[model samples]
Target chain A: MTAPHEPIPGTTIFDGRMAMKGYPLNKMCYSFNEAAARQEFLADEDAYCAKFGLTDEQKTAIKERNALALLAAGGNIYYLAKFIGMLGLNVQDIGAQQTGMTVEEFKAKLKAAGN
Target chain B: MAKIVGGVTTSHIPAIGNAIANELFEDPYWKPFFDGYPKAREWLAEVKPDVAIVVYNDHGLNFFLDKMPTFSIGAAPEYQNKDEGWGLKPLPPYPGDPELSWHIIESLVNDEFDICSCQEMAVDHGFTVPMALLWPDQTQRPVRTIPVAVNTVQHPLPTPARCLKLGEAIGRAVASYPKDLKVVVLGTGGLSHQLDGERAGFINKDFDLMCLEKIVDEPEALAKYSIHDLVRLAGAQGAELILWLIMRGALGRKVSKVHSNYHIPISNTGAGLLVLESAA
Candidate 1:
C-alpha cells in the first residue's frame, strides 16, 4: 500500500508469475481444457482443417513437430503416437502401451525415464 | 491543449480479436455475442476520439512470469506486435505520440504520480483487443495513445481504492498537461468473468450492472469493494474491473454515461463496454 503513483518503490513490471495471477486461465494447468480446444481435437480431418484453415502441409508439420518433441524426450513410441493422433496429427501407433497418462506427468515421466 | 474527451471501459478477451478480424464471429458460437453491441459500433464511429490512454493488464506477455511491474507506461514512438509462443498476429505496429507521452510523464510526475516509462516494449492482446474493437477501421488511430499496464495478474494486487486514486492522479496528469489534444482514457477488462477450473463460465449480470452503475454515478462507492469481493462474486478474472475504476477516477466526480453495452456470449465471462463523458 504505497502512496498513490509511488509505484511501490522498486516495482519491476516484467514478472510473469504476478501477471499470470491476474488472469491465470491463459496459462493455468499444463494443457487447454476449453471445449473449443477439445472440439477441435476431436473433429474429423476435413472439418478440423476447414475450421482452423490449416493446409495439409501445416497439419503434417505439426504432427512431425510433436513427434520429434516426443522422441527427443524418449516418450513411449505408442503413447506418443496416440497423443499425436488425439491431436488429429498424422502419426500412427507404433505398438506402445496405452497406459493412462496425464500429459504433464507423461512428459515428466518420459524425461525421467530416458535420462 | 489536451482536453478530456471522456472514458471507455471494455473487456479485452483475446478471442474477440480473432473472432472479429478473421470474421469468425459468424461462427454460431461467437456471432450472436458481438451482435448485441450495435451501439458500440455506432459510438466508435461517432465519438471518434483523437487520442486514448489505454489502461490494461498485461498477461506475462511483455513482462515474463518471473518479474512483474505494478504499473508501466509506454512512451515509445511505436510498439511492435509480440510473439506469445503462438506466433505473432500480423497487425500493423501501433504508432505512439512520444511528445504527448513525455508530456504526460512529466505532468504525472509533477502531480506526484510516479510513472515507469518504456521506450521499447511489445504490447500483447490486452492492449490490441480494445484497440481493434473501438478502431476496427484503423482510420485515423485518431487517438494517439498512452499505454498504461497494470499488474492485475499477481497477488497483493492493487486494491480497488488504490486503482481509483491512481485514476484520479492520471486525470490530473492529463488535465494539467500543456498540450492541446482531445484525450480519452480507455480502461480495458471485465464486467464479471471467471476463466479458471470449476468456476469457469461464471457470469454475474447483477454484479456487472452494479459495477456499471457505480463506475459512472458513484465510483467512490466502488472503492469499498475489494479484489476478494470481486473474486468471490464475479470470479478472479472479474477483479480486472479494478482497472475500470481507475478510468472512472481519472474522469472524476460525475460522469455522464454516453453508451454502455453488456453481453455474455462466452463462458463464465460477461463482455461489457461503456463510454463516459466528463461532467465538465
Candidate 2:
C-alpha cells in the first residue's frame, strides 16, 4: 500500500476519502450537465440541493458562492465547476473569490507567472 | 502496420471554446493562446495522419464519481459532446474508428493495463477543445480519433511513470495493427494551474517549461515525479500533465520538435502547445 499523502497547504487532493464525503454534492453538480437540471436548480436552489442530500456544510458553501468553503465541504473542483457555471460565473471569478483577489488582481497574478 | 507520424500537446481549456465560438482569436486577451495554434494546424495539414489518439481527462462530463474508470477508451462509432453547463455549445459528433479502438484495447490489456472500454462516452472539453484547436473546420476534419481518457479528476490518479508505460503500450498497439495507417497522438491539458481551494489561480512557469523541455528528451525524468510531487509542484489541476506523458511515450525514444508554444493566464491556467515528429 502507498504511504498516506502528505498534505499540500492550500490544495485538496480529492482522493477517495474526499470523494466519498463529497459524493452527494458532486452528484448534484453532475446533474447540471443537463439543461433541465440546471434550470431546475436555478428555479429552486434550496430544494434542488436538498434533493441531492447535500450536507449542511455543502449547502452553506453553495449559498455563499465560496469555492474554498465548498472544498472544505468535500467538493471537487471539476464537478463544482459545473455548479459555478450555473451561477453564470467562470473559473476566474471563483478563482478571485478563493484567493481573496479582485478578478483583475487574480488575472494579473496569472499573467505575471508567465512573465 | 501503422506509423505514428507525430504527437501534439495543447491545453483543452473550456474558455478556448468560448473564444472560438465568439471568434475572439484576434482578441488581445486571447491572442497569444490563439496564435499558438496556427503553426500546429499547419503541421497537422502537412502530416495528414489518418488517426489521432487524444489523451485527456474527463471533467464531470462523462463519468461522475458513481462509476469512475481510472482509464477509459472510446470504442463507439462516434463520440458526442454534451451540454457542460455554462452553456458552451456542444460541437458536432466526432467520428471514431471502432476497429482501431478494439485493437488498442486488446493490446493495452495484453500489456497488463486493464482499462475501461466504453462503447459510449460523452467527451467534454478535454476531448473537444484540442480537436477544435487542431481541426477548426469540423466538416474538413481529416483525422479520425481514439480518445484515451485518463482519470485526473479524482485522486489516486495514475502516476506519471505508469501513464508513460500506458502510452508505450498504446504505441505498441498501433504499431502491431495490420492496416497501413498514419497516427498522431495528442496529449491535451495542462502546463500548470490550480483550480481549487485557497490555491486557485496558481500557475508555475518554471515547472511548465521544465516539463515541456523534459517531455521531449527525458520523459523518464518527468516520470520520476510522484503524483503528490506533481500536485505540489504543478498545482492540483496542473497534475493533468500526466496526460501529456502518454502522448510523449507514444513518440518513442527519438523525436524532433516541430513547433512549440506556451502562454499563461488563459482563464486561470497556463496554456501550452507542442508539435513533435518521430525521428526514430
Candidate 3:
C-alpha cells in the first residue's frame, strides 16, 4: 500500500493499500478480459458499476474517464487499462489525458525520449 | 546437462502485437522498433534452444489482486494467450514442458524461494508478444516454453536482487535436469516507459541504455537497484526492467552480447531487444 516510501513525483505505486482500495474497480476491469463482461458493461454501464459495488469515487472516476482521478481512486493501470480500452481508448490516449496534452503532443514527447 | 545457451530479452508491449498482426514491419513509424528483431530471430535460429524459460509479469491475466503470488511458474502441458480486453488476436497455444516446469518448481522451492506452481495459466501479451516476435512464422516454435512470472503488477514486488537470484535458481534447476536440452531464457518487457498516473509519458533513455549495457556483463550492478529505484528511474511500468535482470542471471557467467536493439516510442515504451550467447 502507501507504505511511507520516498515518493516518485507524479507516480503512484499500485501497492497493497491502493490494491485494496481499487479492488472493486480493478475486479470489474479484470472481467473485461471476457468478451461477455465487456458487452454487459457496455450495455448497462451504471448497472455494471453497481454490480461491482464500486465506491462513489471509483464510479465517478469511471464516469468522467479521468485517468488521474482513477489512479487517485486506487485504480491499477493494468486493469484500468482494460476499462480504458473498452471505451475505445488506448494507452496513448490515457497518457495524453493524464499529462494534459493532445495525443499527438504526448506521442511527440514519447518519440523525443530517443534523443 | 542442459546447456544454458544464453538469453534473449525484448519488449512485450501490446502495440507490437498489433503491428505484427498488420505486417507493419516496413511502416516508417514502426520500422525502427520492428527492425530490432531480425538479428534476434537469426540468433534464435542458430542456437535452436529446445526449451525457452520465459520471464515476464502477468498483466492481470492469469493473476488478479484477489490473491497475488510473488512468483508463479507455469507447469501446464500448453499455455494459451487470451483476449486481454484489447482484443489482440490470441495466438495458438504455446507448447509447455510440464516435466521441465515441475523440475524447476521443485528446484526453486528447494532453493528456498516459495513458488506457485500453476497447472492452468492464461498468458497475456507479456508472455505472447515476445513469442510472436521471435517466432513470427510459427516455424521458429515447436520449442516448448516455461513461464516464470515475477510479480510486477503490485508493489513490494520481489526486488531486482531477488528476481536475479530466482533466475540463477532457475539456471541451476535447468542445469541439474537429467535430460540433455538446449535452454533459452527470455526476459521480456521494459527499457523504461510508464503507463499510469500523471507520469504516464515518462521514459528514460539514459537509464535504459545503461541497463542494456550492464545486463550483458555485470548484472549484479543492475541488481543493486531496489524496486523503488527502478520505478523512480524507469517509470512505474518501466519497473519491468527486473524481468531483464532475471534473464541475465540465467546466462553463463562469461556472456557475449551478440545482438541488441533499442528504439523509442514503441507504444509508450522504450523497446529493447538483446540476443546473448553464453560463449563456449
Report the lDDT tens digits of candidate 1 across residue range A7-66: 321122212342333232222211222334445545654455345444454455334543
Per residue, candidate 1 scores C-alpha lDDT tens digits across B233-267 of 66657788888988888887778888887666443
lDDT accuracy of residue A63 in candidate 2: 90
Candidate 2 chain A, poorest ten consecutive residues by summed lDDT: A1-10
Estimate the lDDT of model 3.
0.89
Candidate 2 TM-score, C-alpha based: 0.98
Model 1, residue A77: C-alpha shift (Å): 30
The better candidate by lDDT, 1 or 3, is 3
TM-scores of the candidates are 0.70, 0.98, 0.98
lDDT of 2 by residue, B1-280 (tens): 8989899999999888889989998899999889988999998888889999999999989998888888899999989988897776656788899999999999989889979999999899999999999999966657788998999888888989999999888889999999999999999999898888888888889999988899998899999999999989999888899999999999888999999998887987888899999974
Model 3 bad stretches (over 4 Å): A1-3
Give the interface RMSD of each candidate.
Answer: 17.2, 1.0, 0.9
DockQ-better candidate, 1 vs 2: 2
The alpha-carbon lDDT assigned to residue B240 of candidate 2 equals 91
Winner by lDDT = 2
Interface RMSD of candidate 2, in Å, is 1.0
TM-score of chain A of each: 0.26, 0.94, 0.94
